[model samples]
Target: MMASNIELEQFYSREVEFPSPLLASHIKTAEREVHTLLAGMRSILRKNIDPSIEELIVQTGSSYEGLKVKGKMELDFMIVLFHPKFIFIPVTSDYSGYCKIKFQQEQLQSEMQSSKKWTSSSPPHSFQYDFTSDGYLIPSEIYKWFQSLADKAVNQNKSKFVRKFVGNLPARTLILNISPGVDICVDLVPAICIDRDLYVVAKPLKTSPDPHLWRLSLSVFEKKILSQHQSSCHLKALKILKYLREHDTRLEETSQFASGICSYHLKTASLHQLAQRPDTPEGLLEHLHQLMDFLIECMQRRELNHFFIGNPSSLAEKAKVPSNITHGERCLNLFDDKFVKESTLNQARERLVKIKGSLPAIIQQHSGPVAYSCNIY
Candidate 1:
């Protein structure tokens, strides 16, 4: 049976949180450390290349990269390095679009290495230079300089607390040990600023075969949109959906559908729904039903068309991007075929049928709730 309105409401109050108070402290702590670390890096970079502050830009304001999910506190900052030598090309593929950042090696290594002390620990992961592959400085390679960067901060009369951030084996994405038992993982994405405001990044795409391809991230614009229209209900609905995916055994463990479904899907669904009908306390259930219906249909069909709904990227960027249909089939191929013998998709379908059946009793408490229709086949 599905969760009832009362049960759902109670769960929402207990589990689903918006701008979760419990996590605020952790988020603040993480942000503070991140800024400090970036400052340290910037300081050392200045000493080495001694370039003007304008060349290396740290984009981490509200419009820049940061996550809104209440469950975990994740912060993203894109470090944009602008050099006349770098070239950027935005490309479209079957799954998504990306902007390729390419640069020549002739002047980069010598020009940036004027300060020899910094290069001793991590010698700029310029393996891209070794191969014929035309490559821009990748972010993961840049992360290798944390120790030297952190040391600069220590010597320059900043807190010694930042020392912990360095000296770790740099992982793919840097995970800093903020404080005892409180740590935040950060992605110091390296991108080349394409236009004044646009950037193309090479963040590894797990869903695509081309993991190293540069993609356009409208993160700054997306954050701006959330700031403009985010309502309590929007975050609440996303949390509950995430909770269901995480806790409900049928959804989390037993369903093949769960593998394909991600927190991003749930969050984007809320954004699209809220844009159409601004959410309210009384209408929370209605919004949830809509999201559930879409999810069910998506799972049944084994194809959920990604929505560019209210994309905050510029019209020019949008103009260059292709329709999502190209990527949708590639995404659909990740899961089991819906009709195959003892198919996981079929099993997932059965689970949704049960959830749909339970909704009647689950939502009976809402006053004259709208009837929800689902294609359970």
Candidate 2:
């Protein structure tokens, strides 16, 4: 049976939502400290380490997007780089939502000639050693170089934070111990700014034979689209869905499928729903139902189109990719066969069916008589 609007509202407020006053206060304090650390690191990188390349640190991910749920306080930052001597060529691949990073022939020839015996540990003569003989920028090598520089910067600074490297090799994770039992995890990702709107990150496939591929990042556009929406309920609905996805035990049993379902997928589904129904819903319950239904439909079909790919009229305009970038007009399916297996999709569909069937009971169980809350740290 369907849950009543009142029940859904109570469930969302008591269980899914965090107290904004507390969340905001905690986030603000954390952001201040994080900014200080980043500023110190940026200064060192520019003046002492590498003056040839310019770096801009951009805050991204759900924490900054105001969609973060409880028990997750990690922050994401993109170290957007612009080198006067380097030119990146974004090559579209057969894999949807993924591209390869290549260098222009002239730039490669010049760098190769100048630095014949360049080493990673040596002073920054040029970035020639980070690329392959064929002019392709190796993702792992570049990541390592950036990591080394970040390590040096952290060491030079006399801050009270202890840094560590975690997660995938593409990014560096810094764990800042602010106080007793309060540690903030910051992920610093290195990216090449192709244009004002377009960025190619050094993210590579976990198991792919080729490690030179760079993933396209639409984080800037996503923030713009999400912020432009007038309805607060839309954002609330997305948060509730993310909380459910993170906490659900049925989905957890299918580990592969659950891992495959990223927060971006939920956000994309919500954006599509928002586009379909432009008018703001009357309440949070209505919006949450609409978003869940849309997500289930996407899972059942085993297809979710990337929000920004091939839609030049609407999302593409929002993306603002330069005409010279040359991303093809074909729709890029988020659930490409190369990335997600057929069996995993079948398992995901079945699990979602069961989850939707008992959603009300799940909500009731989670929503206690008193509202649930957590400490920020």
Candidate 3:
């Protein structure tokens, strides 16, 4: 008979809580097996140093790195120490994709930092939500785009997508993965307390080697970090850029009635022909431009109506717009050397235009359709 998954999960949980001497022996055995797989790579870990921080350290096994290596090497290992107060939030899961979860998390963290009672006393909390969130579905159309790029990978480009993201410690960082097995559960997860301090608990889970993990990691980290700093603007631009790159001028019609073919003559074409053609690059660009324009205009108008004075730089410098913009006030720029400049506004405008130009010929080939797509974004 085989042990059920639930039974195995329960068994693992008990090893944390009860830790019988017999179970301890089993843990050692598991650690030995894991170490064998590592082949004596120097282990890096974080240890609790204060209420809010875990210190980082690296340790080598009973061996040196420079010697001529031949056979595989193995050494003992241990799970990183964990504090118990924080909830263990898994940032990746087996069932759904990771792109949305990572985006949501970055958005949530940004919001938290902007709140009135922000503090550095607690460990940061992270989580991976189920796939039903609105953010998750927005990017599904791009999955096909990623797949095409993956197929193009050659020996010269294998490491192009991999990068080290953490500032203080060297560790692999990526935001997307398909596997449920990788230990994405944060080590020492943090929880907030009444005194505004934080508590951390549980180490991250270890994962088996899987190509999906690598792919997902690249997608999530890159997407999330870019979205965070660029304030959703860059992501919108990038999406349009990537779309044009993938589809080119080929019309492969999907099964939606609201859709129609790109760059084909309408009067003499059959409904099937119209539906089967690729969507227009011009239409896509127009859609995206409208969105970016709207956002920029709102921000600009808010600034102008508030003070009705100064330049763009001053408005950008303010922590918050004055009561006039929100309360009652042509938008005006309160100028400052650091904040307002003609170049900045031009850059924003140019970004919109540049994204519009980069689409496939099916879009750019026509004027009206390109306008539609740019506006949609």
Candidate 4:
């Protein structure tokens, strides 16, 4: 038996939606604390570590998107480097979503020489040791430098509210313990904003052939799209889908798959669905079912394109694309070999089917005289 709309609505209200009062009070407080910590860290980096380096901190990911479900308050921050003396070199077709970066030494030297500003100590620490002899920026070396600076900042931070700080190098993450049993996982990514919509980060996949290749980041554009296009029903459906992906044991078994169905993949699927059919005022269950069907179809076919890659009109009416990036010509497949294995796709398909099948029972089990609080803002 299919779950009734009322049952589904009740389940969503009780389980999926993040409580609004808590979000406004507690989550917002935590967010402010995190921002304060980052501000102090940035100051320490500038004053003590690297005087020439400047960083612009940007919050990204599900938490900022308002797609975060209950019990997960992790935040993502992009520490964007404000160095304009770097050039982005697009990698070969083999690495579609990655690019290699190089220091623009020749251009900088020429310009500085012309202006009589070329001094023996002009080039900063990054331009000196973070690049290879051939001028290509080495990802590992740059990450190491940033990591050391972050470590010093964390140690020097005088905020007694932050109980503990843990630095994860390989994943480029920092875990902060704010209180007992409550920890916020902050991903401090080092990125270079190539354009308004395009950012290349020092993060590389584990199986990447060349570790120096930087992965592309479109978090800012993604946040804009979701904010502009997402309706109440659309946001609820996405939250439920993310909750399922987090709790599904079968999907967890397929963790060996390099990029097995990340939250971004699910967000991409929802965006595609929204593109095909613009969200309406109602039909939460219908939209949820359609999103599941869309994901299953993509898994069966093993092809899900990155939303902004091939589609120029993916952006909203007010959004503008930069002249540097040419959309529609270059497409990135989210389900490629580097992303997911066939076995992982098959398992995810099966798991999604099981979840869809069990929805009725699950909803029925949670159906009771529960107060409906309109708290998803």
Q: Residues 1-377, candidate 2: write the lDDT tens digits.
A: 77777886676677766567856665666566556655665666543224233435677887767777664456778877655545555555465456766654456446655765655676434455445446777777777767776777667665665544455666687776656665667778888877686777788876477777778887877777776763577787888778777666443655543566778888888878766676764687778877877777777777888777754445446556544332463667776676567677667666666667787776765543322222232
Clashes of 3: 51
* Candidate 1: clashing pairs of residues: 2-358, 4-362, 63-220, 94-326, 94-327, 95-327, 98-215
lDDT of 4 by residue, 65-156 (tens): 77876555566777777555677887756676778887755654455456553468765433534454467777766677777766676677
Runs off by more than 4 Å, candidate 4: 26-55, 106-126, 131-133, 166-171, 250-259, 280-282, 314-318, 323-329, 363-377
Q: What ordering of candidates by lDDT runs from best to worst?
A: 4, 2, 1, 3
Task: State the lDDT at 35 in candidate 3.
Answer: 35
Q: Any idea what lDDT model 2 has?
A: 0.66
Q: What are the per-residue Cα lDDT tens digits for candidate 3 across 1-377? A: 33233432332233211223533343344343323322222122112211222232112111111110111121211112222332222223331111121222247657567656546785443322211133322122222222222223222233322221111111211211112321111011111121111111111112322211111111111122223333222222323323332232233323111121111111111111112232334332343454334434533442212111121222222323223222332222222122334444444334434434442333433222111010100
| Per-prediction TM-score | 0.62, 0.81, 0.21, 0.81
**In model 3, what is the error at residue 282, expressed in angstroms?**
15
Sliding window of 10 residues with minimal summed lDDT for model 4? 368-377
| Residue-by-residue lDDT tens digits, candidate 1, 53-136 | 233534442213123433333455666654555665544544344545566556555744763544657555333342215454
What is the RMSD of candidate 4? 6.1
